[model samples]
Target: MTLALAGGALAQDAQKGGTLRIVGTADLDHFDPTSGALVTTNNFLRATQRTLISYHASTDEEERIRPVGDLATEVPQPTNGGLTYTFHLREGAMWNTPGGARQITSTDFERGVKRMCNPALGSAMLTYFVSLIDGMDTFCDGFAEVEPTVEAMKAYIEENDISGITQPDDLTVDITLSETAGDFIYMVSLPTSAPAPIEVLDYMPDGPEYRENFIASGPYTPVDYVPDASLTLARNPAWSAEADPLRAANVDNIEITFGIQPDAAIQQLQAGDADMVYDITIPPAILSLLTATADDKVMTMSAGRTAFLFINTVSDNNGGALKDLRVRQALNYAIDKTALVQQMGGPAMAQPQSGIFGAGVLGYHDFDLYPSEGDAGDPEKARALLAEAGYPDGITLKMPYRNQNNQPEIAQTIQAAMAEAGITLELTPVTASDYYSKFMTNPRNTEEGAWDIAPVGWAPDWVGGAARSVFQPQFTFDGRHQTYNYTDYNNPEANEVAKQAINATTPEEAARLWAQVDELVMADAPVVPYYSEQVVLYRGPAVENFQPYALGGQGDWTNVWLNR
Candidate 1:
């Protein structure tokens, strides 16, 4: 097995000191690491955030997903029946502070976890910690009652304590989990678990004041940030290449300009006006043009991102038809995934998916329960299933899709296909930024039938052995904070198996258990899995070392330097 951050620098000439321009249409969901849920946010944070363990910008498949030390000295092994973990802060993982660049302490790490449960703009992934950490749920429940004001939040954090997290010394951080989890290290690798400086408590989490007084624990510090418009990054003087292994800090500065269309953004890159893309994938036409010309700058890679449609079981639309497994299965069988694939930029860019786990993910295996000839849906079978489910007169569903990229076209394709089987779709196009924050993650939207179905995408939170990343967050529900589990789907039997997989002794054992959970989840038919997508990334002429990072589905910001 390969170690994470093994020679973190990409294989490129040691060229340095140039501005890398990033163009996109969406602003970051949140500036604070704790609240960041988007892949683009993680990519940007790789430049300025430090977690206990982090992924390296390595090209090797095995090395890229491995967890490596960042703020922590190393990836620590668990003791006490895999329930307890102790990690020491490294020598020079410093935070850009008011007084000076101070070494981040274990106290900062503990504070970061404490801030994860803050009622105001806290982490969407807080359930991962609250469910695993021994006393975190109790702390979060009490904190939820406090005023959302900075003083109240700050006082609660300082006054209360989580028995699961402790600081033995200024540098040593210890954690006690409720159960053994083989993939626990990958959870901490998330940007949400990064250490937070004490200065952040003065402002609402990720508010204007917090962004203005932003601190840096990684290579770059953000400045001059205008919401959905532009942001600038400057090299942090405190960042030492000798002290850090995950990022090389090759560029002197970064300028992110939002609101650029995909076509215009790619044109800028071709014209050498921009060095990289920010939020959008390359337009299919542009990808074709570049690939036809055998352009060296154009590269297609897999980042384990899969697109699917989540069925609203909680919705009462059409007399709650979606709550029936047969109706969901009918929707699955009726979707012409082949047409969906063509709309996704052809066979080269996407492959039809039929199960909960996307292709190449840890638990993924080829299995389409609703088999169709030529992979082209069976409308007759779908009509029969709908009739059996008491929707013989046909049913209508409201579906929302992100307006950005080719989703609008995909939504139309789905509408046209399902129409053949007596399923009427009233499609609603949504803003990319608001699609998750305002719609899908809101359980009320599901209950109120605001949207009975939606096309959504998922990329692993951390890559290697990340079955939980795909399943636990997006599928299972424990009645905690409603998050990626948009459909209110819950299977206690499968969830228990997930717990068993998490505690499995070996990779093979865990993978076997994960596969079982995948099969079980599909039997319930909560989501209509569509296609596993291939990423098309275009780098500017001046961009160098544009290595593919699995987590971000784009070039690694920590590795890319500018030849210009």
Candidate 2:
């Protein structure tokens, strides 16, 4: 399991073995791989967990997202007409067990997949698996009927099996998908697919008890984690460089400090007090200053992310007006996209989006269903639509925004534009960590009409040829809403087209169908898509072998070496 190093800074002789400090604002969503939802979570888990397949930590934009063998000895080609993936696990990929070093095997992956529908904080990326893997839905349905306690969850896991997955031997894993998916390799590369040890079955998924008894399959083992405060990861005795090709494990220890503002974090980086950021993006003002100074430390990378106002079509607010197509279109017409882009640090960092797909995502194409003057928006068009929808005077709507990275300002911008179109907005602010977990992703909130529209953002689950990653999780393909679908909006036409796009034999055919799905989804106006986001990052002077992680939208933490 060896490959040539390919990061932009890997050419330099890396002075290995030092403590690399990481600073950030928000705490990690999950310490466990099966439950990780955020890109930052993926970044953090890379140090402590090993997936079946993984992308290299490279500065090359395209190469960084390409999947290669990690815990698996080699990336396998599909057999049985592309529905079968047989992973050959590497021998030396060991877990830091209390008993001693223990080799991870096929059963660990089986347990990991079974834990997805745990009645406790279950896997947010469960949608990716249940639909693709054969009999997974049945397993999840059966598991859901069990009690939420750790004992019950573990009992059910032990008693049942997912029929799609099988263990031929200790080191061999066989996964049978119901349908052939071309990008299944990339899907396996995600943290959600990482193998879970038997010890984890004793605790609830991602509970404090599980975090305390953290195990490691990668170069580092997480320890001393305090939610929203700090964490420290020390070298894992069980891990060896030969077992995995993706991470260098140059840093002997990794220290993480939380609750630091982005502006202050950037300054700390320049002073060599920190190596990288954990979760927050650099402030636009600070990024501008760094860019103007021609700082090589500054990195501007393309993120397969989109920022938008997610409309609650399920809400009964304004007399269930959001469900009306005319009202939803009015909401889109009333948004000043140029203002939104400027708040996101101008066109250099973001572009006004007109469709569901983000810029650089596989199926993305230029299309404007609601064309506005200079992207400044059309208040007249909105008002006309509002009148047509029976809101003669105006409609009042609630908007909640995450309190991080210029979002409050962006929300204000949304409020001002909506005002011009006879729509009044009531604003609510939420902490970044709780924004999704407590408020938005909870379908009950939308059903209760707690929020009419909310500022939301999304990065694809995987990078290349990932239209399915973007569209599938966030949209309703069947009657059921997946993880990221905030409003639970459904369209039968869009669902059928999405199936076609994902199953298409060629990239050309897939893109064409995905493009059609995008139009069908937008025509319903479930969300007022604003901009495709590009993140600007700054690393500390001591951070060497730095690479732009397209998913994390920051420098690679697991692979980079410390220079100081």
Candidate 3:
């Protein structure tokens, strides 16, 4: 397969009509990018929507280390020592409507950014992505106590009292940062930068309607959507050939289904019922089948998302299980990640993720001690530690799991390991929707149904420590931090250390500090590391110009085509 950037050259005789059916295990709790805060949902938005500047899927290794550009013609560059960024908007870019009419323009970009940054809009992305843009932080702060209301946010924007953003002209906007940000390009690739004509999200604060009905500036526009079930896309007729040369406007429709299990999705793919499946947890059965059929038709790809066990430290229940660092460490040591991955699939096909940022990311180190000598599946050692803590049996711990491809089997593997280590794990697998809402979003409390451990994953929003913000305290409501720092394993010193790493002056310094943060996390054992997923983008044998990588979906499918 050719490694080409998004919108690169493709076959001239590519089929102009066909349907691509994509099936996956789950759907976003909500379609709104700011509110859903789930990576799975965001993946759809990435392909179906467009960001101002996206990291190029086919840049050099160094350029790929950070985002280059996806929508914007060029990557934003700073004029001063990273204080000011001059972004040149791509000309002729316009929004696409489902009805196949004309497109919209730069104002859409402007309003989108404002909506995302608006605190009253109640977008969690504001806490994550808004911090990157100039004055956005201040604009957000201006609304902090002003009630999270749409009218208030719109009024704030109309008055132009936002601190960091300056739209001096219609096409030219200047962003002044609070401090020097060398990896500004990385910040641009986040969903917050993905423009959403402010008008669409104006009154609607929370719901899937906005995403299902809203117009987009992407290659495809949402033509149909069924709640928690399916979404269909049609070529954006407004897509200009000058701006997006490889736009197929072909493949008559792209249909995406949600809530279908990965194993089911794989079966559908084998039966030719589906064209692609996202959110696939590598299952051993599927891997064997793909390997057996290597000659005929099969391809698998690994994306940059990492799955792990989120141990809620702040939970008032669980009887201080997470409070004991020794217990956390024991849990970390007892589980055989290699066995888990193998049970799920092959090691060659899937890598065990070590840190928050997987292989595709820079400054990532295999900091987690799993896969190391003495740490991998040391059941005796784990038991010894548990006994040392107090040979207390009958500790029925609840473990939550979402129905991914191999999750049930994976959970069994973990349960078996923990049981052998003298810890009783009660497998409580919940529906995908309830699993996300109850276990994931619930505040940490004794009353809130707590889980001893649950699967959690993240896709980097930006390239730097900002990507690590999920682990930060602010992201969690007053109660739970189930994402990363969920274990209530708070260390003021470590917090300061990570802050120093994020705010570090140089890349080298920042890397050193990030290493320190990793060391702290591993030492604390807040999470048990799991496999890094291989991005699997299934296409018919006739399809061409599609590359799969960690950065984004289908690794720039802009030039993809089907043989008629």
**Top TM-score hit:** 2
lDDT of 3 by residue, 511-564 (tens): 777667666666767777776765545554555555443344443444455554
Each prediction's whole-model lDDT (CA): 0.85, 0.85, 0.60
| lDDT (tens digit, per residue) of candidate 2 on 414-522 | 9999999999999999999999878887879989999998988888887788888877778774555566788666778887888887779888998889899899999
Deviation (Å) of 108 in candidate 2: 0.7
Residue 267, model 1, lDDT:
90
TM-score of each candidate structure, all chains considered together: 0.96, 0.97, 0.85
Q: How much is the lDDT of residue 213 in candidate 1?
A: 91
Cα shift from native, residue 141, model 1 (Å): 2.4
lDDT of 1 by residue, 1-564 (tens): 433233354344657787889999888888899999998888888888888998767556677777888887799999998899999888888899988899989989989999998988878778678879889989989988999999999999989999999999999999999888888888999999998999999999999899999999999999678887899999987778878877878888899999898889989998998999988877777777888899998777666788888888887887787889999999988999999888867899999998877766777888888889978899999999999999897789999999887788889999998999999999998888899987887778888989988999888888787888888888777776457888657899999998888888888888788888988988888888889888778888987767777677778887778776
RMSD (Å) per prediction: 2.5, 1.8, 4.0
Order of candidate numbers by TM-score, starting with the best = 2, 1, 3
TM-score of 2: 0.97
Q: What is the Cα-based TM-score of model 3?
A: 0.85
The local distance difference test score of model 3 is 0.60
